[model samples]
Target: MKHNVILVVLDGLNYQVARHALGHLQAYCDAGRAALYRLDCELPSLSRPLYECILTGVPPIASGVVHNDVVRLSNQRSIFHYARAAGLTTAAAAYHWVSELYNRAPFEAVRDRHTDDADLPIQYGHFYYADHYPDSHLLADAEHLRLRHKPNFLLVHPMNIDDAGHKHGLDSPQYRNSARRADIILADYLQAWLEAGYQVLVTADHGMNTDRSHNGLLPEEREVPLFVLGSAFSLDAAVRPRQTELCGTVCELLGVEHDKPVCRELLK
Candidate 1:
């Protein structure tokens, strides 16, 4: 693979909320440099299951990561797996569950918090356990990985939006403020990443609801925002991309061969 990618999952950010709060990203969309799409995440709209779904192009029922607590390594091949198989480097600054899925299961914070094992699917990782770990710090961790390791595929998962939603509900200022904050933090490094030749995908595993909890079929829980920034994307508003399609799209962006279906319409 000759190209690189960074997938940022703004944990629990809703489509409506993102559209209103992510002004910096909206600027890219306004300038026609990015495409914003609204997509329904796979059920049951939980983080862990959808993480596997987004990375493997497989639904929860098929992947068997049907809930957040199903702690085990993914049986389905992920973007990290495909990237690694292609002899490309992979890294992530994400929730510990991500590490539990790709690197090791039953996360041991002391041993698994910082991993740099070549044998692991995510070769370089900085995994965090707390929900309030701070998005700014996570993005900084991701930037550090990008500058140091130059991974072909990097996953940046931040939990602040979800954390705010859980604490103050979706309609509260805290949730909206969190989205706004994440956007500002992203604006800080987006240009640098683009100049460095990395295609970026900003999205979420699922959305937060008014109930301050998810795992149901409500629109707020299922609907999420996808912002694609790169020359590889077509930026066509008519093309609807699925969460499951992300894995294959990323594979295509990195020139990795995979069986999963790519979002052909979304690609140039």
Candidate 2:
């Protein structure tokens, strides 16, 4: 493991939508510069549960994070904890929920779900509810913070697609447009991280259905994308890795060891 990692989780995005919007994906895959995967992230596809599974390499039910209202995670074996123990700086830029779970994590968390990462206080600008959390600002601010912090283990979430799906059904123009926007921003960050000698993994927590619903066992809700770039992975490989596998993949990338039911080395 000679490289750092930047994992961009496009919350609730699908491969078709990503391919249609992020044309660069297919191009990079064709050029053998990245690996694209379609995988299932098991039940309770909600963000909180999915994130717990992704970080701990364990299923939601087993991990005890079956819902979004999970107060905090005391899992000492979490990816963030492993990264810290491995002597790598970690940062998660998204909503506050991630920080709440990894609050004890030695991370420069710059989430605006309730706290502001800027000079302005809460009275000046802050999110009071999930509904008020705009993806545009969150993604933009997160991007800047990552560039500044330059953490070896970074988890950046661009959630406008999920937000759009919630507001407008899957078939709405806004939903597709939101996916396209995510691609634009992700592409930029991907390039930046790659140029800085960091491997990048882009995936989704879950997928959305036509009815703008999830947390079910539908194909759309279960299947999500896993795109890896600037790693030791074989380019253009047909990888159907599980979502939970990403946790250990990152640990392997950072030369960190984990206990019990470790995920496989996906990129290799």
Candidate 3:
């Protein structure tokens, strides 16, 4: 059977927080239905650069998206780009920076907010500008796009955790609560997606620190959780994965050729 894939990036989710807080995702790991990996996200661990790293499999220094302020169209081929090149549909319900990276540069809220352009890497997009935009709403938008387009590759990014971390330190109740909320929300749709034969990967761009900021080499700021659910994965705990391998892994799941390196040991 042909497989579809969904990549969910829960921004600013720390590995220890996910191991402790995300009960729903943990249940899957406990039941042997999902594999959980501790990944150290690329350095200069900010959002946009990590987003670029996650999607393009290129590190910030090489990708030239070293900071969140450097907003422009990405030069590297993303999973969406490879999927589209293979005549597959792609969709994303994510931050505006995602739209800027894969769809257009300098995202104009008026022109790029809700896009449906066949020529773009993300053929269907629901991009939001506000960091405070509710995760519930973003998930709803992703569900809407899924039902409407049935895209071969889907990207679902939510910002609430990151926003909470920026406002409150990573150790605060607010940050933990945000991760819990996202886990609760995922429980609503994950079963249906799995039943529908979609390969799903839930991870983070980067982690947050107790200092209420990132862009450091600290484990709390660099390590994040990766939860995988699908037949393509082996759930082999021995095979550690890096953030850069996500793009290649997704490309392989979609049966597309890619130059990015993949974590082959993690796959059956």
Per-model TM-score versus the true fold: 0.99, 0.85, 0.99
Q: Kindly provide the TM-score of model 3 when superposed on the true structure, using C-alpha atoms.
A: 0.99
Stretches of candidate 3 off by over 4 Å are none
Write candidate 2's Cα lDDT for 1-268 as tens digits.
Answer: 5568877888888667775677776668778788778888778988888887787777888888888877664463677777777666676666555665665232233444434332211111122235335666666665665666666777777677888888886678988888887776666556767788888888888888888878988877788888888856655454457776788887887777676343354556
What lDDT tens digits, residue by residue, belong to model 1 across residues 78-127?
Answer: 99999999999999999999999989999999999999899999999999
Looking at candidate 1, what is the lDDT of residue 208? 87
The global C-alpha lDDT for each of the candidates, from Candidate 1 onward, is 0.93, 0.70, 0.94
For model 2, name the residue pairs that clash: none
**By the lDDT metric, which is better: model 1 or model 2?**
1
Q: Show model 2 residue runs off by greater than 4 Å.
A: 74-76, 104-136, 260-265
lDDT of 3 by residue, 1-268 (tens): 4579999999999999999999999999999999999999998999999999999999999999999999789999999889989999999999999999988889998999898998989999899999999999999999999999999999999999999999998999999999999999999999999998999999999999999999999999999999999887899989899899999988988999789999988778
TM-score of candidate 2 versus the correct structure, residues matched by position: 0.85
